[model samples]
Target: MDIRLNQLTMQFEEMTAVDRMTTTINNGELVSLLGPSGCGKSTTLMLLSGLYKPTSGEIFFGDKNVTRLDAEKRKIGMVFQNYALYPHLSVLKNIMFPLRMQKVPKKEARERAIEMAALVRIDHLLKRKPAQLSGGQQQRVAIARALVKKPKLLLLDEPLSNLDARLRLEMREEIRRIQQEVGITAVFVTHDQEEALSISDRVMLMNAGSIQQDSTPQQMYKKPVNEFVASFLGNPPINLMTVERMEARQYKLENSAQMVLLPERLNHERVRVGVRPEDLYLTDKDSGLLSGKVLHIETIGRDTMIRLKIGNTSVRALVDPKHQLQTGDICTLGADRDNIHYFDCDTGERVNVEKEAQGDADTADVEEYA
Candidate 1:
C-alpha cells in the first residue's frame, strides 16, 4: 500500500486546492496531512480517494497508476469527519456493507464484519443502530465499517473532530491501535498539531494549496524548514524576534540592550530568531540574556506559562508550576545557544549557521525531549 503523488495538482475553477504536491506514503505507515482550515489537506485526501481527478500529474499506488481510477474501484476506505453512517442500518449491516456490495456470501460477510467490529471494540454494539450509540461508539462503528473491507489504503479526514476533548483522545489512540493491528497504510487529515504529532509516523504540513514540509514528527518540530512550519507545529507557538547580526556570533535584540550569541556566525546580516516557549528559561536579571516584566501567569496543571514583556516585544515562557512568580515580578529570560533558531529575515528560510571551524552545525546540542 505504498502511495506516490507525483506533482499532483487539483484545480477547481480559478482556485487550485492542491499545487504540485509530491510525496510518498510508505506501506503500512500512518502519515498525517496537517494544516489549518482551507489549507488543502482535505482536498488532497479527496484526490487520493478518487473523489476528484487531478488537474495535472499522476498518482501511483505502488506501481499501478490510480489517477484515473474511480472511487469505488480504488479499494480505498474513507472515514469522513461526520462519520457518515447510515442511521437506518444496524452496526453489523453497516460494517458488512462493503463486503455485501462486492457480492461476498452473506455468511462470510457477517463473519468478517464481526471480526472487524471486535478489532475496533464495537462488536457488542452490532445489534444497535447508529442513533443508539454515543459519539465515540458511532465513530468506532465508522472505523469498523471502513476497515471491514480490509482496504489497502485507509483515509481518515478528521475522524475525531466531532468527539469531546476526552473522547477525542481516547478515539485517536484506538485508531492508532487498529491501524497498527491491520497493518494498513493510513492517511489522516487533521488541523490539530498535537493529534497529528501524537499518532502519525510522519506528517505532511500543507499551507495555501502547497506542501510546506514533509518529515517525521520529531524532525518537523526540531528542524523545521521555515517559520511557517515552526509556528504551526507548536502549541503555545514558537516565539519570533527580529534581530540584527552585530558581528560574528553576536545578534542585537530589537529595542533592547540584550544580545544573543550563537555558536557560529550567520550568513545573513539581518535575521529572525525563533525560540520555543519551553526553551526560554527564567533566570536572574543580571545573568539572563533578556530582561522583562511578567505581565501574566497561568497555571494549567503541571506547567506554568508566564507572559512577559521584553524589549518592546511580548513572549511567553513555560516554567515549572512551583516557581513562585507573580504578575508584577521582573524576570530575565535566557535561551540556550543550541535552542535558538535563526531564519533569513526577508526569505523566511532557516539560516544554517555552522560552528566556527566545525564546518557544519550540530543538532545534538539541544536534547530533543519534546
Candidate 2:
C-alpha cells in the first residue's frame, strides 16, 4: 500500500508540529521518518496510523482519502518502542490477541498466531510469557503480534530503542527481512542515524516540523540539501571551516593565514567548507594545508577518530587505526577539492562550485593556517 500526505499540517495550541508536509511513499517501500526529538516525525507517524488527525490536509491510503479515519479502522499494524505486551498472556496468546479481539475463530487465530511467531523466529517461545523472554525475544513477540493481523501497512516507532547495541542491530535486520518477505509498506521512525540509514529504502530527514531531505541514505549523506542536513547525517560529523575570501580563487581559514584553493567559478566572498572526517587524509606536515597538533584520539574497531587543533578551530578526521599518533603529535590532513561542500555563509545553503576537468584538476593547492 502506498501512503500520501498532502499539505499535512498539525498545530498545537500555540505551535505547529507538522508544517505543510507533502510527500509520497511508494508501495512495498520501507521508508523511515528520521530526525532528532521534537522534529514531528512521531506526529507524522501518528497521523499516518490515524491516531492524530491533521489540523489541515488530506491523507490517502493509495487513492482513498482517510485523513480523519480512526486508528482502529485504518487497517494498519503498529509496533511501539516500549514493547507493550500482556504479561498475563503467553507468546502464542499474545500473538493471537489481535485476531481474538476481531472475533476470529479460535482455531484459525491459533494457526495464524503460530505462523507469525515462526516468521519472527519466536516460535520456540510460544509458551513463555512476556516477562520470561529476553529483550530481543520480547520485541520479536511484539512484532509477531503486530503482523498476525496482516494489516495493509506496518508502522514501527523506534522499535529497537529498548534493546542493547547488538540486539538493536540484530532486530533491525530481522525487521527488514520480515518486511520484505511480507511485502508490506512499512514506515520506521528512528532518531538513530545508523538505524535509519541501514534499513530504510529511503529516508525522510525531518527538523522543526519540516522535511529537510527525502532521499536514499547515500544521497542524504553525500549530497545533503543544506548545512543542517550535511552536519546531522554523519557519525563524527562533517568538519566545517569558516573561510573568508582572500584573492581570486584563494580563501583563508578564520583567524588564520591558511589558504585554500576553491573552485575557479566560486564568486562568494565568504563560504563554509564542509568535508567529511573520512574524506580527510593524513599527509606530511609541511606539505598538507591543515596541519595541527593532535588533541585527542578515539579508537573504534579498525577506525580511529583523531581530533586536531588548527589555529583556534578544532577539526576531526577519521583515519586508519594502525597509523600511530599520540595526543601531542603534529598531524596534517588534506582532502580532495571536489569532495568539499561549499555553503553560503549567510543562508547556509549549498554554493555550487564548478570543478575543473580531471586532467586539469588541482587537489593540493593549499597552505597550512598560521
Candidate 3:
C-alpha cells in the first residue's frame, strides 16, 4: 500500500515534534525514516500507525484517509525498539495473541502462527518463553508476531537496536528478506545510517522536525543535497576542506599555504571541497596534493583509517590495510577531479560545473534531435 502524508504536523505543549511534513511512500516500498534522536522520525511513524492524531493535515493509505483512524483499524503491524513480548506467553502464544484478539479461530490462529514462526526461522522455539530465548530469538518472535497479522503496512521502530553487533547484522538481512518476500509497505525508523542505507528502498533524512532530503540511498550518499546529508550518510564521514580560488585555475587551502591548480571549471572564489575517505590515496611527496604527517592510524583488518594533518586542517583517508604506514610518518594524499565535490562554503550546497554543462549539452542535443 502507498502512504502519503499531507502537511502532517505534531506539536507538544510548547514545541512541534513534526513540522508540517509531507512525503509519499510507494506501494511495497521499504522506506526508512532516518535522523538523530528526537528528530520526529518516531513521531511520524506513530502518526502513520494511527497511534497519535496529527495536529493538522491528513494521512492517506492508498487514497483512503486514515488520519483519524484508530490503531487497530489502520491494519498496521508495528514492532518497537523493545520486544514488548508478554513474559507469561510462550513464543507460540505471543505470535497467536494478535490473531486471537482479532477473534480468529483457535485452529486457524495456531496454523497462521506456525507459518509465521517458520517464516522467521524460529519455529523450533515456539514453546520457549521470552525469558528462555536469546535476544535475537526474542526479536524474531516479535517480528513473527507482527507479521502473522498480515497487516497492510509494517512499522518498525529501531527493531534491531537491542541485538548485539553480529546479531544486528544477521537480523538486518533477515528483515530485508522478509520485507521483500511479504511485499508489504514498510516504514522503518532508525538512527543508524548504515542500517537505513543498506536495506531501505528509499530514505527520508529528517532534521529538526523537517525532511531534509528524500531520495534513494545511493543518491543521498553520492549526490547529497547539502553538506548535512553528505556528512550524515557516510561512515568515517566525508572530508570537508575550506579552499579559496587562486590565480591560474589554482586553489589554495584557506588555512594552509599549499596551493594546487585544479580543473579550469572549478574557479569558484571560495568553496568547500568534500572528498570521501576512500577517494583519497596515499602517494609519494612529489605526487600528492598536500603533504601531511600522520597523526593516528586505526587498522581494521581489511581497511585502515589514516588521520593526517594538512596545514591547520585534519583529514582522514581510508587506505588498504596492506599499505603499512605508522604514526608520525609523512604522507601525501590526493583525489581525482571526479572524486572531488565542490560546495558553496556559505550555503553548503553542492556546486557541480560538469553536471550543469552536461545538462546544457543534453538540452541542446534534445532540441537538435527534435
Candidate 4:
C-alpha cells in the first residue's frame, strides 16, 4: 500500500507542528521519517495512523482518500518507541492478543501467533513474560504482535531507541528483514540519522516542522539539499569553513590565514566550503589544502578521527588507524576535490559545484565512448 500526505498541517494553538508537508511513499517501501526531536515526524506518523486528523490537507492510502479515517479503522499495525507489551501476558498470549481482540478463533489465533513468534525468532520464548525476556527479545515480541494482525501498513516510532547500541544494530537488521519478508509498506520514524540511513529504502528528512529533503539514503548523504541536511546526516558531521571570495575562483579563510583556489564558478563574494570528515586526507603540511595542529585523536576499530585546530576554526578528519598521530602534532589535510561542497554563505544552500564537476566527468566519459 502506498501512502500520500498532501499539504498535511498540524497546528497547536500558536505553533504549527507539521507545516504544509507533501510527499508520496511508494508501495512496500520502508520509508523513514528522520529528523531531530519535535520535528513533527512522530506527529506525521500519528496523523497517518489516523490518531490525529490533519488541520488541513488530504491523506490517501493508494487512491482512496482516508483523511477522515479513525485509528481503529485504518487497519494499520503500529509499534511504539517504548515497546508497549503486556508484562503479565506470556509472549504467545501477547502476540495473540491482537488477533483475539478481532474475535479470531482461539485455535487460529494461537497458530498465527506461533507463526509470528517464529518469524521474529522469539518462538522459544513464547512461554516467557515481558519481564523475563531480554530487551531485544521483548522488542521482537512487540514486533510480532504488531505483525500478527497482517495490516496493510506498518508504522514504527523510534522502536529501537530503548535497546542498547549493539542491540539497536541487531534489531535494525531484523526489522529490515521482516519488512522485506512480509512485503508490507512500512514507515519508520527515527531521530537517529544512522538508524534511518541504515534501515530505510528512502529517507524523508525533516526539520523545523518542514520536509527538508526526501531521497534515497545515498543521495541524502552525497547530495544534501541544504546546509542543515549536509551537516545533519553524517556521524562526525561535515567540516564547514567560512571563506570570503577573493576573486572568481579564489577564496580566503575567515582568519585570513590561508587562501584556496576552487576552480569552480561562484556568483557570490562569500561562501562556505563543506568537506566530510572522510574526505579530509592526511598529507604533507606544505602541500595540503588545509593545515593545523592535531588537538585530539580517537581510535575506533579500523578508522581514527583526528580533531585539528586550523587558525581559529576546528576541523575533524577521518584517517586510517594505522597512521599514528598524537595531540599537539602538526598535520596537513587535503580534501577530495570531487567530494567538496560549496554553499551560499547568506542562504546556507549548496552551490552545486560538485554536481557541475560530475557533469563534466560524465561528458568526458561519453565523448571517449563516442
Each model's lDDT: 0.87, 0.88, 0.87, 0.87
Task: Write the residue-wise lDDT of candidate 3 on 17-42 in tens digits.
Answer: 99999999999989999999999999
Worst 10 residues of 4 by lDDT: 360-369
Greater lDDT among 3 and 4 belongs to 4
Best by lDDT: 2
What ranges in model 3 sit over 4 Å off? 284-287, 321-326, 356-370
lDDT of 1 by residue, 174-259 (tens): 99899999999999999999999889888899998888888778777877788899889787999988887788878787887668
User: TM-score of predicted model 2?
Assistant: 0.92
Model 4 TM-score is 0.92
- Residue pairs that clash (backbone atoms under 3 angstroms), model 2: none
Per-residue lDDT of model 4, residues 1-370, tens digit only? 7888999999988889999999999999999999999999999999999999999999999899999999888889999888899988999999999999999999999999999999999999999889998889988999999999999899999999999999999999999999999999999999999899888878899998899988777777777778999999897889998888788777788885777767565666888889999988998865578887899999866889999987789999899887778899988888777678878888888787533333211222221221
State residue 357's C-alpha deviation in candidate 3, in Å.
Answer: 7.6
| Candidate 2 CA-lDDT value | 0.88
Note the clash tally of each candidate: 0, 0, 0, 0
After superposing candidate 2 on the true structure, give the runs of residues whose Cα lies further than 4 Å from its correct spot.
284-289, 321-329, 354-370
Candidate 1, which ten residues in sequence have the lowest lDDT sum? 357-366
Order of the predicted models by lDDT, top scorer first: 2, 4, 1, 3
Q: After superposition, how far is residue 231 of candidate 1 from its true place, in Å?
A: 0.8
